[model samples]
Target: MRSKPFLTVAHRLAILAYIVVALFPLFWLLKVSVTPNDLLYSEGVRMWPSRATFEHYTFVIAHSAFPTFFKNSLIVAGSTAVAVTILASLAGYALSRFRFRAKYWIVALMLVTQMFPLVMLVAPIFKMLSPLGLTNSLTGLVIVYTAFNVPFATFLMQSFFDGIPRDLEEAAMIDGATQFVAFRQIILPLTLPGIAATLGFVFTAAWSELLFALMLISGNDAATFPVGLLTFVSKFSVDFGQMMAAGILALIPACLFFLLIQRYLVQGLTAGAVKG
Candidate 1:
């Protein structure tokens, strides 16, 4: 019992340290966002401001085109998340269960796709899309983001599917269900954690992605939040306050998304689905 107390204290301290390290940047972002511009330079390195204001947030929301960029980002990220998760779930389950011809070659091909730097493909992708009127379009951005994100998402989901047992589906099929029904009814419920994790991963990736969004989208109408943040910079000066405020606001959806799905992420729904 005495040893248990010591272990509990140690565990709590470790968690506290990790929380502080993880949340420090976010705390600083909030601190700086509220600090007045005049004090920004004058304060130098204070941990907290002498005073705080909501002026930066007001300016970003009212005076800037951040709202439009935010809306576009939400649309792009949301669509990409759904598309990637759906494709990855199907592909992952197939990879986990099916033994078919050229499986090694197929996996190797997917790995090969991930090995190349995206920059190398930008020129080729742009040239390809230009002929099809895809450049400067939201649909193009969605399609591109979905494609880039799917390989990684598929690998993530495949790991989860691999964790689940095959017995559940086999039992479901023996009970007069088709393969698809067994998958949809029995196996899928057990993969909720994997689905939640995959959705969170893909959504955050697409939400913060800047390179492809910047390159493919030429106009404000289709600009993602990351690209829109660049507009806060001018030749003469950068609006640190507005940019930080927008940056802070940009985090809300991701935070909410994780919060919403976190329940599934925690419950090990597959725990009893298989034998030890």
Candidate 2:
């Protein structure tokens, strides 16, 4: 009943509204980060402050322990992403292509693992890591993240592999290429979108994770960004400006990481849409 132009305009408006709603918190964070300390309490909720300053940003970067926290988060997230992707790719391929005994049981066990709350597992994980000198360490964090992320990542990659025809790999094997060689040289290239998605998901999960980082890492030197954010909260007050500034700074790597993979991310996310 509606005109095409009217429907088109409605669609666009809906998308614009969604974008604004999604980004409003980030806009508020930036506004608070740049607002001067004096005007924050004096003036309640202005779209833009009368004046803004970089003093919070300066203090967070130069005077605080944020850089160390940033570095630790980067290391843990990067390592976990790479490790989980590699392991998941191999495991997912096997699950998609091979028929073996106890496969269903194995998958069931993995599903069971995901069912338990992470909080329930944390104490035992810490106990297991402490004896091995892995607690309070980045390597420990990477291992923990990889373990937690692997099941879902493997399932994600398995779905991607399922979407592809198996004949391509068969053709490669027929040409005298071993299965592993064909996988590494041929199929892996086609799976880039899935790899990007898995890397992005795992990286983001590890990046913003607060519980494990807070529980495992006691020393400030080993703390990740999520844990470091707590430093802004003291006995009586929270430093909203510096904390917001740190939050903004913390958003950079994640943004850049996704930007780097967004091409593949788009493909990965949309690949399933055409199936219907």
Candidate 3:
């Protein structure tokens, strides 16, 4: 009985340790971004520099093509998230609530798509997109991101649907609501947490995607944030300070995006806690 408190204390300590470990990189990134170029190498090992300046941030914002990169990434990631969520919601509802022929095969096929290496697909995808005048375009990126994200997203939404009671939808239908009407009004509201989860997942995936962006977009005009970060690198040296500053800046939109959906995210975390 006395061991219970000890175990609880140990568990809390472990979680605290994990949080510190997980956040250490972000802390370091913030630390280094504000560290002046001179002090960066001179006092790189310090947890916080002796002196810090926002020169790196100023340079990244004022002099670089980061704004364009930021805009491109926002458009691609946002579009992909919305598109994936809408399609996944419909497909998931179908998979969860309805049984049809080839259902098993369809699920298996989606699983198979996830099995292959993304690296292997890069060359084929590039070749396919190149001739369509999409190699250096934002639309191309959105289409690609949506395709890659949909299968897993469908599975995610389907799980949420499965958690819902079919009786609710049936009752709605019995009250003269059509299946589509029941789904739109009665079911979708209850699945807000799942939709939030899917949006966050897909948005982050598209926002941080580098390999596809790097391969598909060669011009700076269409380049995403990840590709834009590479501009801070050159043959002679890497601009660590500016790069870190840009990285810190890049995190803002994603953080804000999550903040916007934080209520649903909290609900997602606490879902299924109590039974009525």
**Between 2 and 3, whose lDDT is larger?**
3
Better of 1 and 3 by lDDT: 3
Per-residue lDDT of 1-276 in model 3, one digit per residue for the tens? 356988899999999999999999999999999998888787648899999899999999999999999999999999999999999999999999999999999999999989988999999999999899989999999999999999999999999998888888898999999999999988898899999999999999999999999999999999999999999999999999999999999999999999998799678543453356
TM per model?
0.93, 0.94, 0.95
Model 2 lDDT tens row, 75-169: 99999999999999999999999999989998998888899889999899999999999999999999999999999999999998887777778
Evaluated at residue 13, the lDDT of candidate 2 is 100
Error of 2 at 122 (Å): 1.6
Tell me the deviation in Å of residue 138 in model 3.
0.8
Pairs that clash in candidate 1: none
All models, RMSD in angstroms: 2.0, 2.8, 2.2
Model 1 TM-score on a 0 to 1 scale: 0.93
TM-score of 3: 0.95
Tell me the deviation in Å of residue 31 in model 1: 1.2
lDDT of 1 by residue, 19-64 (tens): 9999999998899899999999997899999999999999999988
Whole-model Cα lDDT of every candidate shown, in order: 0.90, 0.93, 0.94
